[model samples]
Target: METPRERWVGADAGPIVRPYAVTRGRTRPRGMDVDLVTLLVATGRTPGERVWLSREQRRLLELCRHPSTPADLASDTDLPLRVVQILLADLHQYGLVEEVPQAEPAGRSTGRPDPKILMRVLDELRRL
Candidate 1:
């Protein structure tokens, strides 16, 4: 039998709040498309005193002060990628963060990769 103090605070103890709890039982982001490479930047707007924010969410905002990707944020926070995406979506809804649009190459109207580059990659792979 473990004492209350030992059970509550121990070297082997896990996080007090589980990942699902942090995300409010949500596995996917709502109304936002967040990918691993999606760039996110803080909107420089502070949350009001009336607004509530979780510890993880605050930390995420701090990390996003400098534009960062979901993958980078996940690695920095040591959280799962899905959790980071959900958090980002929440921040976006709150107007605390926004996605930075990636610039397109010149003369490339469509987002698809160039076929010549694909052919070159295939040839290189076949040679290996």
Candidate 2:
């Protein structure tokens, strides 16, 4: 006796999994700190070698093999943001993955370039 709301009348009708369950009731990421933009990549081998991880963690490892951010992983996997961060930190602890900080683009000048440097560049261009 389930209503339409309870059963969304689709082939993929299943109970929604809570984030707490995914994280085993953990509230915060351990040791490592992560943000939405923090990039992660696998360590060239399977993570959680001696431990059993949730299905979500395994999927995250696969997704991060080529470098992915926590935001992207959360959006793509439909997992909570905090949950993803905790999972990533856990993997990092096990040496299954590493955090790769994104660097600011080099092309962007913090402020106006030094007038002397610009003048030199202009002079060099004039010579050519």
Candidate 3:
């Protein structure tokens, strides 16, 4: 049977678009590796329009601004660790963040995922 990963077709290659925060940076992408924190703050600018964020997503973004373990972030944010993992994966895939590997999960653990998986998923999404 085909898996979710195998089911993708196309229509997902386009860049991801998300609203930014209050602060932003000046340099353009052609000049430098974008600072995600600065870029996040720079993306949203609808003069009179309002921006909204859930308490959890906001907290998740804050935790992500620093290099931290998913377990640590989940504990700090009071969210289930798995949910934190999922959110980070989403953020990374959208090019809003990057991740570095840490210790491996214990044998009894469900196991951590590889960030490269998102690249494959992104390609599949593009194909779909």
Top candidate when judged by lDDT against the true structure? 1
The root-mean-square deviation over C-alpha atoms between each candidate and the true structure, in angstroms, is 4.5, 10.8, 15.9
- Candidate 2, residue 110: CA error in Å? 12
**In what order do the candidates fall by TM-score, top score first?**
1, 2, 3
TM-score of candidate 3 on Cα atoms, chains taken together: 0.37
List where candidate 2 sits over 4 angstroms from the true fold: 1-13, 104-128
| TM-score for each of the candidates | 0.76, 0.69, 0.37
Q: Write the per-residue lDDT of candidate 3 for residues 1-128, one digit (tens) a residue.
A: 97665455335633322223211221123222322222221122222224343455567666666666667776786555545555555445444455553456566354535568868989999998
Candidates 2 and 3, the one with greater TM-score: 2
lDDT (Cα atoms) of all candidates against the true structure:
0.90, 0.84, 0.48
Worst lDDT window (10 residues) for model 3? 36-45
* Total backbone collisions, model 3: 6
